[model samples]
Target: MSESLKNKTVRGVGWSFVDNIASSGVTFLVGLVLARLLTPAEYGIMAMIAIFIAVSNSIVDSGFSNALIRKVRVERVDYNTVFYFNLAVSVLLYVLLFLASPSISVFFKEPELVKVTRVIGSVLVINALAIIPRTVFVRDVNFKTQTKVSLISSVSSGAVGIVMALSGMGVWSLVGQQLSRQSLNSLFLWVYCKWKPSLEFSIESFRELFGFGSKLLLSGLLSTVYQNVYYIIIGRFYSSSLLGQYTRAEQFNMIFSSNLTSVVQRVSYPVLSSIQEDPKRLREAYRKVIKTTMLITFACMLGLAAVAKPLIVILIGEKWLPSVYFLQIICFSGMLYPLHAINLNILQVKGRSDLFLKLEVIKRIIAIAPILIGVFYGIEYMLWGSVFTAFISYFLNSHYSARLIDYPTMDQMKDILPTFFISSIVAFFMWCVSLFDISAYILLPMQLSLGILLAFIIYEKLRLPEYLEVRQLVCSLLHRKNKLDNKQIWTKN
Candidate 1:
């Protein structure tokens, strides 16, 4: 990689890391308070409407934001076209969802979801408005602005959610949180991003983008639907309270998996895309990203799994104990999510949305049987099925990456397996520690510290390239910070 691109990638990762930590931390805290305040049934109501909001947002985006990012030369017409298209789709989808909310409520046997769905679905419109501007930031590798936007949105929205929960708003508090975040995110993006759409909308530009993006649109819609299918099944077949427990468990898992994966994938895609034409460099860069992502995310997921019990009991109380096992099981699946994401990103980087869609179809097909079988058995069965699917999905996601740049599934696995094995061993040790009859407050911290310390010690002893690279990256960042501080002091003097 060029030094400029390398530096951009590092800076992008830095901002993304800070953004995710701050945003996820605030959301995690707010969720803890809300879990204490609201019942599982209330959270289940929010979970019930989650699919509608997710699917609507996906349709509104229609993969155009990615198309914009992937395009080497973006025209003003492309921006205007995507902007208008997203706006129209968002409005139409929201209206459709509004009208269909009653049917959804009926399907889930939850009468309260009718209004909740409509209120939360409004976020699609707010989200749609910000797509163009956000795409600009991402395409430019300008994550600093994105970080500020996320921090502001997360903090403000979390505060609103907490206040509303305290004021007895129940599920509406969750809805308010969603709305506030999206509204603020859009508002901030507009204020920060100077780009604006003109009255012009070009059919040619639309077709150009759509030609590449339509497959992604289908793939995204399918992926979104598949991801949320469990919620639908649980909500429909089981009790709302049960679904709420599952949702809470998934949320805890996601606080680590999703945020960390977002940080790596967001930085990896644009940086990798910048070097797509050079197979040698692309392969090398891709491997490094995979190793680094695996190292960090593996440790996180496994460590969180080991500490799930004590952490859940201490943070959210005993009422959420049922979610502990669920969280643990899901974290196993979450460990490979960054791998899945970054592999898929390689396809996008190589402009193979067709292969991307094809892979999605195949994986989703493979996923269906496991999910169906699990549903017949039980929730735990379904979760174990998810673990099965996650492993399978990794190979499927990496198949094209191998063919494209010779970074095959087995090669990628070999690169990541050491980190995975070491982390797993450390996590098991942590779990053993947790078995002691100690206070959850004490046990949680102990497990975290020991797991982290052991993982670091093992990595250092192994002299793993990825671990050393990460250490160097941190040291370089600190060095640069000190130099900048010294220069600022001199200037002030």
Candidate 2:
């Protein structure tokens, strides 16, 4: 409610937007370069280890970092406790990852993983060192500094990746890029924020934070496990090349969804935490967030799904053509990832993590495991697995959250139905266009503009008042597109 906090919130949102643009842009560029340079098979090997590494890393933080953020009564010493706790976990993870690397290689029948996993696995320590500084920065909403640090680190990592890929380092190029980014981020954070821990641990402080943290940790672990289980299952049964293709397709499709949702998640958590007490006001904010998220998130995923073939061909080259269906399938499913994430965070903020835990267990079974079975059946089945699991998980999470927030499943569905109908029509129409070989330089924009314009027209025609408010929101944004559009203009006179 104070002026300082309001400024901090605004700064956090701005920082998130900038960080998403800079980091996602850099990642997109470097990823394109790597995709061009490395074979899908090589990327697949990395994907396999990524599954292991991601799950392990998620467990390292679980949800405690968020718990630290949301906890209202945190003491100054609580910061160090969370830091030490994360540090201990990171060290233990490194040892475990190193020891387990041989078995991982043996299990996957890829002996190279023994070395590769251990090397990439060192990021656990780097990431752990980052937790406290990031936590403190986020706890206070110092997004401007965070964004600057992130931009530098992202650009640096991208440069590392490109050079490594050009030098024929293969998979290690990807590994090196990741390691450099994590190390640089830690260094930046340490320099940017003057918060160092004493050699101290407080059980009491830990206990205070743990109340909120246990829920976040459980939610985080389950969430991570669910997200990556497909890779694990696929890598176990399918060849690394196939996994690599699928991973690329999936990752490429995720650019908009992840960038947008991650921005909201990082920004919303602290914002929502600060406004947790008044259920009416909290619910209002939640409604707007959910609606806005639905509008962009579904449209993004749907657009990507409609153009999976061309997108894969254009961006990743003909070598990865096999991933077209995989991309299309996963793109549709990923739309719901953001909503599920935000809704789950509501439970996290309300201190009703018991609900979150139960939801996670069901979600893994309903959403994750079935997809693994889809791989068991056939690769074509992977697409269906994605669609089916998304429906089930979305409905389930929406239902669960509706109880607490009192916003029904239909309300959420109502917001996106326009997107659903518009996307379907565009997809059907685009299918007719795709029947021939139209050059993407012409087709991509034609389809994109058509889809967007059609959606806007339809939304205005039917939901004009609602769309007007959204337009106002956009115009009111501090960084408007018109400014950028005019930034590089020339005066012919």
Candidate 3:
């Protein structure tokens, strides 16, 4: 890859940091408001609707975004073809979702889900429309426009949701917010980009894109099925309250996990696609990406688990105390989420979609059946099943990463072992601190401060390249300010 490409990737990631903060802030406010406005049953129904929407979303775009970005020579005709194709599939998906609404409601024994499913089903189509235009923004590395698009969408949705919540619209508020965001954002994206599609279809171009799309489609399908199966199983077997509890916990876990992955994956995939021919540089880039992703993901997840009670108590309410355990388990399950995105991108860039799809399919087959069986025994067993699935899935994900780098599975583990080990040891000590006869207010902050201090100290002691980079950044800013002042003084003289 050219140095300019690397610089562009760096700039993209830097700009995306602002997008992340905007998204995080809006989501936090909306989640807090909605959690109070809606009940567990409401969220449970929304979760089922969310599952359908999410799974459908993964399939709707035909992975055209990735396919377009990966290929060296993209055409207006091809882009238009993908756009029209995705629009067609998205319409079909909406119809299918609407048709499935009654059955889905019956499947869960929640008749009210019919309306909810149909309402959120519209978003599938809206999101599909957004894909081509949104990808256009990212293709040329114009994250500034992308950031504005995202911020406007998020803030507007949050405003609409708050109003709906006040008017007793409940779940519809969230549904409307999502649909509005997609609709408005797609409109904006179309206006921002110069590219517009013609009503043209090419069989050859379709095959080229679909060949990649099929693998991503399958991988996405399995991953989606694997994820929703958890909620489906829980909802089918347990009460709405329990399912809602799991859903809330999972939602919060994903808010962090998805945001982390999105921030990095958005930058990583395009960059990887550009660097597809060079293995060594790609591997090095992959390593740094994984390192930083793990450092952040592991810390966020474990830290949340460590302070689960306080967070839930402060954020939700006392009624959600049962969810604390589920939240903790989901946190651990999500620990590998952010870092694994790079591996997925590597597979996408290498055009190994078939292998990627097969890997996840095999994983779900091997992983899900046992969990399904375990749940039949009891809820406690089900919880254990979740914990078991997470560890095994992490290993499976790493298997793909290992194949890419010609590194051993354990060596892959070795890459993240330091953070894992340090986080575990620190969490254990903090747990010890929690055992003391003091209020959580005291112990929580104490452990939070001390544990962070210890982690930073250990990280500093290791003196990773990132540590030196940070130090240099601070020094450079100070030196630049001095230079500016000196230049001004010299001009005055």
Candidate 4:
């Protein structure tokens, strides 16, 4: 990789991590407050309609953002075309969802979902307005600006949600949070990104981008639906309170799996795409990414699983204790997610959206039996089923990456195995620590500190290159910042 691209990737990853930390921290704290103030049934109500909103959001972009990012040189008309197309689709989708709200309520046997669905569905339209600018930022790898946008939006909206929840807004507090965040995020993106849409709408541009984007659209739609299938099944078959517990478990698990993986996936895609022509460099970069991602995420998920009970009780209180085992079971599956994401990102970087769609279909098909079987048995069965399916999906996601770049599943597994082993050892030690006679308030921080210290010691002793790379990058960033501060002070003097 070129030095400029490498530098950009490093900077992008740093800013993305900062963005994830800020946004997720705010969301986590706010969720803790809301969980105490509101009942599980209230959370379950929002979970019931979450699929509709997610599917609508997918339809709005339809993978055009990926298409734009993949293009060698994006034209003004391309942006204008996608902007208008997304806006039109989002509006039509909102209208359709608005009309279908009653049917949704009837299916879930919850009449309150009708209004909640309509209100939250509006986020699709609001989010569509910012697609072009967000795409531009991603393509340019300008995550510093993206960080500011996310932090402001999350903090402001989280505060609003907290206030409303405390004031007894109940389920509407969650709705208010969603709407406010999307609205403010869009507003801020428009303000920070000077890109504006023109009156130019080219059918040719739309068709050209759509050719590549359509496969991604289908793939994304399938993936979104499948991911939300659990919520659908749980809410429909079981009590809303049960669904709420499951949602809470997933939420806590995602704080590690999704947020951190997003940082790697976002930065790596554009950076890898820039080096797509060189298979050797691409493979090397891909290997480094997967290794580093697994090193961190594996350790996190395992450690979280070990401390799940104490963490939940301390953070969200004993009311959410029922989610403890669910969270622990789900973390086992969550550990594989970063692997799945990085492997799939290779397909997009190689402009192989067709394979992306194919893999999605096959994986979902393979996943269905386990999902159905788990649902039939119970929620615990379903959670264990997910753990089984996650490993299978990782293998499936790795197939195309092997063909395209010669980085086979076994080879990838071999790369991550050492880190996985170390993480397991550390998690075992932490679990032993939890068995001690101690209060959760003291145990939680003690477990965290021990995990971090053990992870660093093992990585250092093992001479893990990814750990050293991350350490060096962080030191370099801090060094550069200190130099700049000194330069500014000298200039003032």
lDDT of 2 by residue, 1-493 (tens): 4456545555566678788777776778789889999998888889888777787777778667887888776666877888888888889989998999999999889988999998999999898889888888888777777788888988999999989999999999999888998899899999988788887789987776776667667767777777777777778888899988888877776687778788788888888888888778778778767776677776778778777777777877999998888887777778878887888778777778888888878877776556755666876676677678778878887888888878788987886676566667766665566666788666777777777777877777776444664565555454544665567564332
Model 4 regions more than 4 Å off: 484-493
Assess the local accuracy of residue 310 in candidate 4 as a C-alpha lDDT between 0 and 100: 94
The C-alpha lDDT values of all candidates are 0.88, 0.79, 0.77, 0.90
Off by over 4 Å in 3: 1-3, 436-444, 466-493
lDDT of 3 by residue, 317-395 (tens): 7777778888887777677777667666777878888878877887777776556674678555665666677677667
Q: Across residues 1-493, which tens digit of lDDT does each residue of candidate 1 receive?
A: 7788888988888878887876777778888999999998899988888887888888899989888888989999899999999999999998999999999989999899888887888888899999999999989889888889889998999999999999999888988887898899899999999998799999999999998899999999889998898898899888889999999999998887998888887788888888888999999998998898888888889989989998889888898888888899999998888888988998898889999999889889988986787568888988899899898888778887789899778888888888889988999999999889999999988988888788878877899999998888888778877998999999999
Residue pairs whose backbone atoms clash in candidate 4: none
Determine which window of 10 residues in candidate 2 has minimal summed lDDT. Answer: 484-493
Q: Kindly list the per-residue Cα lDDT of model 4 for residues 323-368, writing each as its tens digit.
A: 9999999999999988888988999988899999999998888879
- Assess the local accuracy of residue 316 in candidate 3 as a C-alpha lDDT between 0 and 100: 78
- Evaluated against the true structure, the overall lDDT of model 2 is 0.79
Clashing pairs in 3: none
TM-score to true structure, per model: 0.97, 0.92, 0.90, 0.97
Better of 2 and 4 by TM-score: 4
Of models 2 and 3, which has the larger lDDT? 2
Task: Write down the worst ten-residue block by lDDT for model 4.
Answer: 366-375
The TM-score, computed over Cα atoms with residue i paired to residue i, of candidate 2 is: 0.92
